[model samples]
Target: MAERTYDVMILGAGASGMMCAAQLNEKSDLSVVVIEGNEKAAKKLKVSGGGKCNITNVNVSASNYLGDEQLIESIFSQFSKEDLLLWLEHRGLKPVLRKEQYYFCPKSSEEIIEILKAASAKSDYKFGEEIISLSKEEHFVLKTKKRKYKAKNVVIATGGKSFGSLGASEIGLELAASLGHESISFLPALAGFTLQKNAFWMKELSGISFEAEVTVAGKTLYEDMLLTHKGLSGPVVLSASLYWSKGEISINFLPKNNLVDLLHNNRRLLSTALPLPKRFTQAFIVHLGIKDRACVDYKNDERALLVSAFHTYHLAPAGTYGFSKAEVCKGGVKTETLNSWTLESNILENLFFAGEVVDITGELGGYNFQWAFSSGVVAAQHIIENNKV
Candidate 1:
């Protein structure tokens, strides 16, 4: 029957929410509180990067991101990569770099969650609470099943609408609307695609991965392309998946070697460079009904055409795995409605937004998590500086 009030209440206790709480609580005057739907916070944290928790990335810049790229530049400037490295080091976390510029904790992801909780306990308020409805009076009022809480400042660290199994959703959009705000369209990002019609080759060559370039149109993919039982995956395909509205993606079966060179040099040895899985090699050379003709087997003009085709393999995906498997959602509350530097809502006074809940989405590697941490820090620091309860 008692009303609980705090200086700051953060929804969603995943990466962004936790960072906001720690930053606020570290300050002397603030009483930082986190409301999480899950019985335990950071369930998504444990599953990220296959439980290693890819925390951030190296060599990231505004160009590596999508969405309102211009506006996102200011946000990154506010909380730079150096800021993330400094903050994580302050928390006693040393991350290891993985392939593809990803940075992950050397320990298990559970350790990452524990580190957050430990810092949160220092001065932050963390309640195992789920908010069902939210409203505002002179101050922001949050309603849970059991009680009501008023906060001087409210932060929607609630992540984007994706990965429902891990409790990701668009609840923040509804909450923002309740307070007279508009949100952006939501889409799945960095997820695998399914085909409307089965590609028989997927069954034949399910797990083949090669270190090669994936070019869509004229742009070269910085990541590798992998063949899956369902479809193509890996950084390049996932990156292309973001821009693919509706069409086939182009892929090169061989990256460095020219089909002509393979043919001219030694038709039989072409397989050495691709080092393709036995099954995929069958599809490319044997099952295709080409034998000794190998690379050199074809005449000059004919070899040229085949080499070009190999570099540009077009594919149309059925659809993505949807939110359930997405690493991050593509869209959220549009950037125009919120302050890029502070992530505060222009429509709602004392209201802030950060993390995947906004339209900004990053390429795979640790960029998404880095965005979450940096954006949350900016929002919390801004609230601490600009607002009073």
Candidate 2:
């Protein structure tokens, strides 16, 4: 059979790939084909944000991400959270702002997925087809198990190696490496941390949650934290994991209250005397080997020790829950190899990278989705505008 030909071939059909295809379909006459290895498109998209799909954040800025700050700033300038919301509204997928930070589809992720599918309906979709080999000569050649295609341009949006159950892969980074690009080692971000021996008592409090502040790597985030059977999780812990490459994390369980004063003058047991959860306080007090005595019964040194412990509970995590539980990867192909404006490879004229496959990784609460959408749109528009050249 004769080899197929197209002007552009987009690998992966996740958030970025589908977004790019949709934009190209509307603005350019270039023949586009989206290849996805999964049985369906946007597998992760369908389940993101517990199916509601936090598409972006209302307070998106370059500060909310980790990567080349200049590149992220440039992309957000092209498509801000406001732009994403407006674009969704225009496409009939109304997004609701929640908690003054997250933008979510009121219905489900399917709402946005359907809009993207409809917008890119003109483009061909090859589901269950994975590109096995890619080479370049006069043009770009992509070979799958069953067929081969030649295209003038290609876009890599294969995403990161997180959530492998949803079909995440490293092919996008691998492709970039083939073209002489620098890639950063990927680490699981936005995941729970497993506690070491000293903090193993936390595991017994599984299912318990509290409002607190977690600090690591000189960065702090205040949110709800949950004690899991494995270790620590929830919003605060997940966010802390973004900045915590390793070492200890400090938790302020009583961030809102001054427990030291209350504890010093208390007549009740340490567990019930403080404002923290009774179970947690009891377990912590016992772990510290403090006698359950009246405040006056304890010496000044003991009071100070208890106060210091409450204010700064240090925990050394053994590791993380790994990629299976990770919401995103922290690194990818370095941004210096790609043009900040177009996300195009500096060495290859028509090759481009976008979304999580790049070194840019956003914090929790929909920042990652926004980055994917913005970068994909920017790359798509750039490719179309320069197609005639």
Per TM-score, the best of the predicted structures is 2
Q: Candidate 2, residues 111-189: lDDT per residue as tens digits? A: 9999999989988999888767778988898877787778888999999999989989888777777778889988999
Give per-residue CA lDDT, model 1, range 89-148, as digits (tens): 887887888874788989888877887778777544445566788888877888876667
Per-residue error at 285 for model 2, in Å? 1.0
lDDT of 1: 0.75
> Which runs in model 2 stand beyond 4 Å of their true positions?
264-268, 293-298
TM-score of each: 0.91, 0.96
Which residue pairs in candidate 1 collide? 248-315, 263-295, 263-296, 293-297
lDDT of each: 0.75, 0.88
Displacement of the residue 116 alpha carbon in candidate 2, Å = 0.9
Best by lDDT: 2
In model 1, how many backbone clashes occur? Answer: 4
Candidate 2, residue 385: lDDT: 82
